[model samples]
Target: MNWGPPRTAHVTMTFDPEGLTRTQREGDACVACHKKWPRPRTRIGRLPDGTALFACPECADALLPQQDDTRSRPQRVAFF
Candidate 1:
C-alpha cells in the first residue's frame, strides 16, 4: 500500500490497549477490530448483517486508508 497523507485522527495517537470509550451512550464494538471506543460520531458503515460499525480513531485511521484508492498521491478533489 502506497498510503497518502492522513485525513483522520489517531494516525499519530498511540494505541490505548483498552482504547477510548463512548462517553454519551452504549455503543457497538469497532467494526474493524472490535475495540469498544469511537469518537462521539464516527459512524463507519453497516455490515451485511445490518450492524452499525463504530470505530475509534485508531481503527478508523487504519481501515479507512486501505479502502481509499488514492494512497501516496494527493487527492484531486478539494472539499473546501
Candidate 2:
C-alpha cells in the first residue's frame, strides 16, 4: 500500500504522569483542567506507557504553540 502521511499525527511532547489522576491518565478527563463533564477528545500528548493524553479544544490550543502565518508576507527578492 502507498498511503501518504498519517491522517492524524501527535507531535506534542510526552508528559509525565506523576501527579495525574486516574481519570486524566485514562483519557476520561482533560489532562490540563481536569474537566470530566465533556470527555476530552484532543490528543495533546502521551504517557510513558504510550497512553494518549487528551484535553479540551481550549486547553489544546493553549498547550500547543501558535502556528506562524507566512502566507501574508511578500515574496523576497535576491540580488546578484
Candidate 3:
C-alpha cells in the first residue's frame, strides 16, 4: 500500500473591514504579509504617517500575489 501526497483543500475567504479591531502596528508581525492582498485594511502605526496593513486571516494566504507572473504590457507600434 502506498501513501499518496497530501491533498490540499480549497477554502473560500471573506474580508470585512468593520470587523477588525484597531490593533497597534507593533503588536502584529503579520501586517507585512498582508501587503500582498489587493484590498488591505489600514490601521494606525507607531509613526504618525505610518499605517498597519491587515486582511482577513484566511484571505491573507489566499490573496497573496503569485511569483514570476508578469502582467501584459500595452504594445506601442506606430502605424504608418
Candidate 4:
C-alpha cells in the first residue's frame, strides 16, 4: 500500500473581499458537491497534475485515501 503524500506543485487561491464567508462570495462553488456556496470551504491539498486542490471539508475527506483525524485544521494557513 502506498501510504504516502502525493507529489504535486504549488498553486494559489485568492478570495475576493466578499468571499470571506459562506454568505458573501457570489457564484462560489464546491468542486465536490457541485453546489454553490457564498464562499466555498477549502483545504489545501495536492492534485495528480501537480497543482493545489481546492476543496470543501467533505471533499477533502474523500480526496485522501487514508483517514487521518489526528491533525486538526490549521488556525490560519498562509500559502505563498
Top model number, TM-score:
2
Deviation (Å) of 34 in candidate 3: 13
Candidate 1 matches the true fold with a TM-score of: 0.36
- Whole-model lDDT, candidate 2? 0.80
The candidate that achieves the highest lDDT relative to the unseen native structure: 2
Score candidate 2 by TM-score against the native. Answer: 0.72
Ranking by lDDT: 2, 1, 4, 3
The regions of model 2 sitting more than 4 angstroms off are 1-10, 72-80
TM-scores of all models?
0.36, 0.72, 0.23, 0.32
Tens digit of per-residue lDDT, candidate 1, span 32-66: 45565434235544434443445567666555545
For candidate 3, lDDT tens digit of each residue in 1-80?
A: 53522221123223333434344243343344534434443322223333434444554445544345388889898995
Clashing pairs in 1: 4-71
Candidate 1 off by > 4 Å:
1-27, 37-41, 66-80
Query: Candidate 4: misplaced stretches above 4 Å?
Result: 1-27, 44-53, 67-80
List candidate 3 stretches off by more than 4 Å: 1-17, 24-50, 54-59, 69-80
- Candidate 2: tens digits of C-alpha lDDT, residues 1-80: 63532222247678899989999999999999999878887788889989988888788888876766668978688975
Better-scoring candidate (lDDT), 3 or 4: 4
